[model samples]
Target: MTDPCGECGARACEELFHGLLALDHSRAEPWGPLHGVSVSCFLLQHAGRLPADGGAAARGLLQAYLDGGLPAVQRLIGRARAANSHRVKAGAAPGGAARGTAVPVGREAPRGGFTVTIEQVAQGGTFPAAGFPERVRAWAAATLEVSGPHSA
Candidate 1:
């Protein structure tokens, strides 16, 4: 295979990539959205804690976190994009900010629901630049066909 994206020294992004693959193999369709959940869980549980915001140092740390999963996320997005199926965009819900809307940091529902948004980052232009988690959530919602609060 031609280094499709000319990935240079991106070995760093492999760890998270493998984790995602493992997830894809083990989970069901609805479980698809769980990609972000599994990743976040792993990040929170392991890989040490990350600071949400800060200076350059903080940004570097976050980048490392992202880079760690860049490759895998790239692969997943490639598969989804190649499938070429359109789904409702995440965050484009009703009564709130649209997908990609930068909101104040707080625990708040973003309008109708979290809409999935995908953007090209680097080589191959299939991977996400930043919205990996949101995309996964959107994928889950679209594939699972579930919404609203669970009746307990």
Candidate 2:
């Protein structure tokens, strides 16, 4: 569904994007021990129609982030790191974050339309490297509520 304020909708997307970036920054050290340590993937699924001024919305989001300065980014990273550390201690698996069901809004997506996939590698803890892929796939399958080999 369309947000009453388009600016607010854009800001929400921007915040989520930044949060993912912060998560990446915090996981950097742990991920350093692995191959392809610099790789990251993000998928943003919007509920409604994209704004006509998508380019302008993107530019505004970038400008906002830039105006926030490095200190703000650092703070976000710090908080993410701390939360990740806590999760590790609690025996949670290290990997990309998972979001729950997507709430419907706006116009419905066309039948068999676009699909987004996000993948990330997490390090640290006793998790086996060889089984990581399987775990990720399983998680994706469960999250998307799909069956079969190409669930994600």
TM-score of each: 0.20, 0.23
Residue 111, candidate 2: Cα error in Å is: 15
lDDT of 2 by residue, 1-152 (tens): 32322322222344444443554455543322211111111121232322333122222222222345334434545555676774466655333333433323443322212122222222232233465444333333332322112112
Candidate 1 Cα deviation (angstroms), residue 125: 30
After superposing candidate 1 on the true structure, give the runs of residues whose Cα lies further than 4 Å from its correct spot: 1-19, 25-30, 47-152
Taking the tens digit of each residue's C-alpha lDDT, what string does model 1 give over 31-143? 34445443332222221222231112222222333445445544554554555444536544222212333222442222212222111111233343255454544433321
Q: List the residue pairs that clash in candidate 1.
A: 17-72, 90-115, 90-116, 91-114, 91-115
Among all candidates shown, the one with the greatest lDDT: 1
Candidate 2, residue 136: CA error in Å? 29
